[model samples]
Target: MTDLMETLIENREMVQPNHANMLESAHGGNVMKWMDEVGAMSAMRFSGETCVTARVNQMNFERPISVGDTAYITAYVYDAGESSVRVRLVTEREDLRTREREKTTESYFVYVAIDENNDPTSVPELTVSTDEGDRLRKKALDGERD
Candidate 1:
């Protein structure tokens, strides 16, 4: 079983106009999609089963991400119950030229493991074995802002 401290998932996507909304910034839908994708990876890593979205606790857009920037997403398992996994998602926008990055969004997404029949399945208890894991867990529990 992968403990919370040992679990890490990350992926990156380049922002394009198709990913942007009318405001010329990354669309909220696109952000949510990336969040779900990364969160599912974390949940699957911890649960060892396919995971489905149960709820999105909160989403905060800290800054705007424009087209041509790279959106870097990172997720990690923080807390878990019998079948649900709590994951934290952080998204950053990096300038393609200078490579300067800014935090574009952050959120906590909950996912539940599912069996072959698509029913909720059990997951291993998450273990926070390091200071970083503990801190991230605390940040998630701290609510919308930290």
Candidate 2:
């Protein structure tokens, strides 16, 4: 078993000019790519095997991340099946100068652990050992219910 908290992954990227769209904000594709990368990392951490993105649930871009702002991506495994791990991903825009943050996107990603032959393999059961881990799992579940 792997503790959910141990699988948590957080990544930050500075939105550069190349990563921005016409409006000088982070491009939706760029944000999605970042989310996928971090989500896979979290899944791999929990499964102890290479994972591939299987599905990405609805992704909503609620706000724009300015070109100069920092994009904060947080991902964690909330649940797992025999071979699949579900990760909750949240992206936020943070202004380093003001220390302000605003959520920009939210989505759930499913990854499947793979062996050296690229065949799906079973993943260990997930465990939540801390209050924070329990809260995160609940939040993901509640969001799905809503």
Candidate 3:
């Protein structure tokens, strides 16, 4: 069994003009690329194998991340199956001056562990052992309900 906390991944990207659109906000595709990268890292951490994105479900962009802001992406494995890992990915926009943060994008991603031969591989069971792990799991579940 693998603890959920062990698969947690937090990453950050500085949104520059290159990542922004005409509106001076980060492009959705760039945000999704960052999310997918972080989510795959979490799945690989849990499975001990290279993971491939199988699906991205119900991506919600609550707000825009403006250029010069920090994009904070967090991902954790809250659930898993024989070969699939279910990860929750969230992106927050942070103001460098005020140090304030607000959620900008949220999504659930499914990844499949793969063998060297590119075949689906089994993964260890997922468990939420720590209080923080439980809290993250609960947050993912609750977010799904909304």
Candidate 2 residue pairs that clash = none
| Clash count list over all predictions | 0, 0, 0
Candidate 3 segments exceeding 4 Å error: none
Residues 1-146, model 3: lDDT tens digits: 88999998999999999999999999999999999999999999999999999999889999999999999999999999999999999999999899899999999999999999999999999988899999999998888777
The sequence of per-residue lDDT tens digits that candidate 2 reaches over residues 87-136 is 99999999999989989999999999999999999999999989999899
Error of 1 at 22 (Å): 2.3
Better of 1 and 2 by TM-score: 2
lDDT tens per residue, model 1, 6-119: 668878889899999998988988988988998898899889999999999879998888888888898988788889988889999988689788888988888999999999
List candidate 1 stretches off by more than 4 Å. 144-146
The numbered model that scores best in TM-score is: 2
Ranking by TM-score: 2, 3, 1
